[model samples]
Target: MFVAAEIKKNTYYDSVYLMRITKEIEKTEGVIDVLVGMGTELNKELVSSLSMMTKEIESLGPNDFFVVAKIKREEIMGVVTKKIDSLMNEKKKNNVKEHSPATLDSALKYNPEINFALISLPGEYAIEEAKKALEKNLHVMLFSDNISVEKEIELKLFAKQKGLLMMGPDCGTAIINGIPLAFANEVSRGNIGIISASGTGAQEVSVLIDKLGSGISQLIGTGGRDLKDEIGGITMIQAIEALEKDENTKIIVLISKPPSENVAEKIFKMLNNSKKNYVVNFIGSESKNVSNSKTHFAYSLEETAKMAVELANKSTVRNKEVDAKCKKAIEELKAKEKEAIASAKNMVGNLSVQRKYMRGLFTGGTLALEAMNILRGRGMEVYSNLAGDERFILSNANDSYRNACVDLGDDVFTRGRPHPMIEPSIRNERLIKEIRDEDVLVILMDCVLGYGSHENPAGEIANTLNLAKKDMTNEENDSPIIVVSIIGTNKDPQNLKESIIDLENAGAIVVFSTAQATRIVAEITKSIGEC
Candidate 1:
């Protein structure tokens, strides 16, 4: 906010106290606060008067306010549009690549038992890739996004015709047999069969179930955005039918974000008629009437998985047993949520072990899915969608992914302009904001290190930490940032540990391996749950 007055030999050009007037500005609709920062000798008296007048005008009426200070509409609009254009470009860049095929021939030459082809290519190219895989008789876990309704229906139908299971086009996550695939959390093998519309929703819940010593029959992802307007629950409809018919599936679990009210009614009706014991989590959706044999409603992904595990292990619950079990777990969980919040706060400064939230900002579809299984065993959430956007996994802004690298054809991690791990400066603000909002509770992160690499990731993270520290308001619980730099001893920079320590000093918890860091989070989460 600036006010300028041209002085010509004391020939007073029409004078107004802009600053004083700004101060007198009234609280009006859509305005949160008004601040004035600049004033000069040429217009000191005028500025002072206007500042006072700003405070005065506020008292006049609801909308009345001193209006001497203003910026050119063109300038403001220009800056805003420029920002928007930059963001749009970033988004476009995120989805710019064509579909990539996996380098599976090499994989096959070495590992003949590799029975799975996790298809994560773009929708346009998915059918072709899937056709080739099905010809090879490989089971596919499709994790691609932007798949058309027609394509998905056709592919699923084709897969069925070939006696194969095609997991998803916009699949969130899935675990098959003993393997956690796609954006899935690690879980033990058991009898609960999960069919979910939300990816992270399914992964988190499934992992919870796994952590409880119970296992899964199969955890299936139906793809997020499946129940939208034109789509009309095609995947869910087919999925529920399939799960109901699956002989190995003793108990059925279904999870989704809030669906349209009308769609909810239809889905619930379908569930009501089903014979299997069920746990449902329509996150942010209403709890509807459940009738017939057995049905349970869970509010969150975590709770949904927990509910599924309990149901899976305990069979033929008597009325008395059901009543007692419900009462106990509900009370216990409420207490746990409180303690978890406290534990997260307490864990801030205690750097006994390195913990990380390893987000594989990967372009490689197969690698991302493979990584998910690896991370899942260690209890870290893996997130990436077919469209290359993981809101729950990555930042919301487009620019944050400007440097991200991926290959649609092969689904491999490729480097982009501003690589997220190397240029933490690009993402720290959003990461800090997410932490403040409690959207994440990560202490450290795992970053890949290979051929073409940034010179100093630890140093980059250190600088990012310094910038974040300057911006943070509530420094008490500034989340413990960490990074697990995955490098072989051969590629180790001479000062790797020292560089990591620099990040530690600037406010980061650095580590060496993704596995080790993930274990820490799992252990911590387990501890929190026990508390």
Candidate 2:
């Protein structure tokens, strides 16, 4: 392989754009991996992690734009570099073809009605850009992560006082005025509105709503940290107010991976005063359900969407077909789990191959939380970095406990790098390590698809899974079962049918719903019975 670096002095692009550019270029033929960004210590560290680092790259300053990649041949280097240039040119080509706005103020001059600005600058500059947008009377979606909690509270409070909504400092998904933004779906607009601190959490519920024959009215993303004690649920409360006053919304759904106790109480107080119907899916929270004729509690994302749709349509009776599917799913899991247990016990006592417990390496944080919750519900002591009892906290994200689920998208794992959704290389790098453990009976995962995610997510790890199986078979141990939940639709850029088939072809059990996959994992754990 060959490593190539391109240095363009005085050229600058925000980190988010660079992330997307790198992903697209990596798809080119003969390209192995890629790093595209301004040359800073963080970028250098990221490129180095992929073994493409060099003294020249390390010497680059923040002002210099760099394209670093590992290619199969020296000749492909030119093609890859040309592709990067073409991509940059394409990004610079705006629809209006006027002078590109140098400042937020100048952009506002071009179109005064721009009430929403999406900010993805570096964290240090995120606050200033957000303030500029707020001053211009525009609601903001801050996609940049790493902004301090203190700054978040300050900006959220300022936006609240001005009566404008601010989505996130690390917000990843939202839909407003019939348009999808930042890791969202293309579901039709209807009467159900969502307020979420979780990115993929909101995406899951909204997409499920679409599948349920109901659609979303709007989705307001409260950046993942909005519900912390520091932010005090500012965007969430603001969104609730906005949705309540909007004539289009008739039902409200709140999605999050649990909130602070004080904040949940504050939200519950707000919920009591609201007139619309409700379906609240607060994963991993011990909060009790409070339901009236209009309010309902949902324990899972699938249930949340179903309840919200039924409330929107005033349906009181559950469908017999749905009940039958549930019964069938439970039965099938039971039978398959029984067979798995027998196979494990009868495998010639190859103690070297006796698989024990489960390990989850998830790219989407919410899906990981969902899996963790389901496992815990099944009486399994599951440890996770993002959600769980403190005792179950992962000592180090890289280490696995009895039953461990690591959110690869967690801040620690993705620090100084792109999200797994943007670049699954890191997850792939780690999955190889996890699969080598014969004690791991099964590996559970989720493949999330939609706008602003990998174009072919399943394909990223599909071939590698086969490699894992081949190696395990060579070791004379049972190959770890790969159970996956694919969250996507036919309309996604990564064709859903192809993605599912890719996994299935690689000896994976691909489930359509995340909830089902989690239950299967729980069942397998129970059947395996602790090694």
Candidate 3:
């Protein structure tokens, strides 16, 4: 065990390049972990968290990029450290067509035909860069969080005036022209387009659409704040108009947590006049029957994707195969629920009154909300940090409430590190401590797999869970039940077949959709809770 560090002064690299380098170094023999990124305060904190910090790193600046690794031996550190530059050089060699732009202005000058810009700089700096992109007639996707709502509104207004899409100041996922962007999945190009205010909501729905043999024409993200009262759905309104006129899109899907009352009313009005068919899944709102024939209101992502497919295939004619796929998956889950509950009751002997609550530790915000809604629908009390009701907000994010679900990917949990989707270290440690509490009856989870997520998320999840359960049973308590909704497709870099097998082998109950997983969770807790 030794640590190696390097500081490249005045160098800039895209996050994608750094992540790839990190993954490659992690695969090297004797390397325990790796971190490669600019020497920003957050990146410095990331290395310091692992005790890999040094005087070199302490002196580094924001514009500098670094590669930090912890290895088994000082000698082996040299072997593994060189892989970063080696692999990155290979990347540069393969890219014969890409011209290195010195700055954003130079980037646009290199190619004036560029239609979009993606800004992931610090939040305070994002608004100015976004304005510059809009001035150049380029759409902007702001991937950084922490931008003020006022700034978000101002930038979005400027974009709307220019008739360009400003995706996010914290937007996580989007797919444009058949290309997957940050935190997105790859799907075939087809007639359906997605406009979402929720990142993981769009991800789950896109994967579901891909699984159903339908495909996506485009996915436009309206940064989560767009629908709030202050911003008022500016980007979404523009997207609806753009997609309505897009000949390639025959059907559209809008997915998000419920918007402000006024914004919701405005959206409904826009949907009413939409010339093309569309489905709406406003999760927090009531399911209403919109009088417009072409507009369908969906209460869940599965329904939204399925309904959009049905409408695109020709409204009123259902795809029996797709319906059967949904039916079959749920039926399988129901059967497993019965078998697992009976087995749990038998193994644990009797239910401890203390072990009667559900703790949802989710990386996907949308999945957490979906599960919360399901439990609420079934008359169960569930608290979520993401919920509008301040009462449900946890006083300490590290602590749990009566019935709690926490989005591990929220800014609170991600201040000094990458998102849980990319780094499961924090969540893994938390889950271990959670399972030790006798009060935790179930741990509902989401293992999201795709590009820009943890390379092999299930590997860490399965291994950590198995180790934690060992300690639980040694104390003569039953292992807490883990129900998972894996958001992925077979086309992902991490093989879907093998990943599911790993989870199954680790004694997890995996479901195809978040909705089914939530149903199973409610049933499990109810069966044990009543006893």
TM-score of each: 0.48, 0.83, 0.83
Clashing pairs in 2: 356-439
Error of 2 at 242 (Å): 1.5
Please list the residue runs of candidate 1 whose C-alpha ends up more than 4 Å from where it truly belongs after superposition. Answer: 1-115, 132-138, 160-163, 260-266, 316-337, 340-426, 432-531
| Total residue pair clashes for candidate 2 | 1
As for lDDT, the candidate ahead, 1 or 3, is: 3
**Maximum-TM-score candidate:** 2
Per-residue CA lDDT of model 2 for 313-391, tens digit only, reads 6642466664454456445645755554454344324444467778888998888888888888878888889755899
Question: What CA root-mean-square deviation does each model show from the true structure?
Answer: 19.4, 4.8, 4.5
When sorted by lDDT, best at the front, the candidate numbers are 3, 2, 1
How many clashing residue pairs are found in candidate 3?
1
Residue ranges of candidate 2 with Cα displaced over 4 Å: 1-6, 16-36, 44-61, 67-99, 289-293, 315-353, 469-477
* Backbone clash pairs in model 1 (N, Cα, C under 3 Å; residues 3+ apart or in different chains), count: 44
lDDT of 1 by residue, 117-219 (tens): 8775535566788767776778677776656777776766676667776677767477777666644444557678888776544554554454454567887
lDDT of 2 at 87: 81
> How many clashes in each candidate?
44, 1, 1
For candidate 3, the 10 contiguous residues with the lowest summed lDDT are 343-352
